[model samples]
Target chain A: MTASTDPATKEPFERVVQAHGDVVWKVCRGLLPQHDAEDAWSETFLAAMRAWDRFDGDRVRGWLVTIAHRKALDVLRAGARVETREDGPPDRAVEPPGRDLDLWAALARLPAAQRAAVVHHHLAGLPHADVAALTGSTPAAVRKAASDGVRRLRALMTEEPR
Target chain B: MTESTPTEAAMPTVPATPPQRLEALHRRLEAAATGDDAPDVHYRHLDSAVGGLLVAATEQGVVRVAFAREGEDAVLQALADRVGPRVLRTPGRLDAAAAWLEAYLAGRRQPFPLALDTRLARGFRLSVLDRLREVPYGERVTYAQLAASADAPRAVRAVGTACATNPLPIVIPCHRVTRSDGSTGAYLGGAEVKVRLLELERTGRLPD
Candidate 1:
């Protein structure tokens, strides 16, 4: 009997995970705190793995970053009312001049629009048009938001680490 | 008021993000992917007495055990080419199989306890493997003897092909079969491995 091979083999899911894992994590971590970012990262991949066949894009990084954006936003909205005293230095802190800055903390302080723009356009390397489509803004607006967010982040990062 | 509020020169650099907890994250995603939507094939490496062996499994059971000679990457691609490409290197799923093989290789005359997926072999080859498994520990059987036992008395050449192509060789005990003149036959894992396996079974100890 001739044992036949599959006519079309799906690309292994592990490859997808390996290829986009870093960018996806960056997008999530840029928008949310460390623990929530970890959760968002996993959620993004689980959703991707489940809907692998339905994946319709050649731009895999864009797709994963979009999913990560959603998960991170979900955490923000879920905890908007309850004061989540996250474990670390306060969301806004000032300390010794030479101390390193907490990037996640700086990211957490940005307004939602700026945060999304920076995460999608800068960290995820998505074009401004894609970020605009994801965030309901125009490409020009996305570019402005990302630059403004970067300016604010640089300022906040000068204060303190913990 | 200004983009230069904290000049690039003055701003403290963000501490390097802690090393990613990728191993843990991978486990979580792999677990979720292996849900009702679709099952994934998981594989792991086992350093045995002979060499590094790759053991792969479907959700049902251990499917393929390949020697390092096969090239681990090529074996994985072949598995993906044949058995849908939803594969991951999740070692936790193969605990039972790993433990059993480790015990067997370490001179514990353990019965083959892991479930086997023999879907890779078909027809006469499948039957030959089935018959070969009953050749007890420390025993030897020529291809003709195994072919006869499988009730295909005239199919000695086919029997050799079956044993050579056996996907689960050491686990299926194809190492027990030899050539008609009592020479170690052509094994998929090489004849030297066959000799070593036979010695292990015969004396219950591996030679250095």
Candidate 2:
């Protein structure tokens, strides 16, 4: 309920980023690789700033998530040169097991529907119905996919480091 | 499928983004937002003889100048209310205004050599401020005389109000409008600054 998230004072786009940036980053990272996630993050915020005057509702997080979803899809649709296990760790040393790289690697293994549902509904904090609408799936199927995605993530993360 | 904390999802402990990467993105956002003219109000603080001056501007021109006596938070809220909510303490946007104020405080007393947006003042008040600026760098005028100059001779009290609410303060030369009794009547920055400003014009130095 503080000024940062409340929007009671008509929170500026800067506060919007300060409050929701980490979640948006996670959503992007879950859907794409490190490089592509960075691209999507930049695009989402810039687009948000451009249309900021017309944004009246209080669902700032959800609004940003929707934009991030579209931007991530744009990157994938452009060339489908998206994240895969074989993309390997970034040019540096292999990261520790519990880091974002590891979690994203496991997420990369899920089916597209499961990944989208899990990223949007879990990481980005969009409701199940909202994620369903964004991906054009029904709520029940989204729920199942997210549950299945979580179940798979738990197992994959606990496996021996590759 | 829980959405508890918007930024902090509790399920998988997402490691914090590296500080360097996060800082790079923040700089990128600031550049892009300014590139698109998104930060509607850019403000900076300047050290001046009178006090710490909060100078804020928009894409239009210099818009607000406040003394330390007026709380910085209140001044910023006023900007957000009157101007736009995209207020950011971005540096470099206000370097020109800072230079002008610094020069004036150093006893140069030149008219502000930049565009000024006086939209906060309206109607006769705006006229009073307009005439107030023309009173010249070294001269002083009575509020009554200023009211006559603005074509509202009987609205002398209104003239006082205009100077009191002047958004630009020292830059617009509201300190030049004095009481007919030859005393500095009132100033947004208080009377002592009014005296020092006049002395700066007369002796070319602010009193120690």
In order, candidate lDDTs are 0.75, 0.79
Best by lDDT: 2
Interface RMSD, model 2, angstroms: 5.2
Candidate 2: residue B127 lDDT (0-100) = 84
Clashing pairs in 2: none
User: TM-scores for all candidates?
Assistant: 0.83, 0.75
The weakest ten consecutive residues by lDDT in model 1 chain A span A91-100
Candidate 2 falls in which docking quality class? acceptable
Candidate 1 local lDDT, B6-98, one digit each (tens): 323332243433344577677777666555744457888898888888898897799899999988767877776677566677788888778
Model 2 lDDT tens row, B1-208: 3545332223566567666766566666666666565677778788887789999888889999999899887887778767776776655678889988888888776735787888888888888888887887789899889988888889989999999999999899899888999888878888888898888888988886
Which candidate comes out best when scored by TM-score? 1
Angstrom error at residue A150, model 2: 3.5
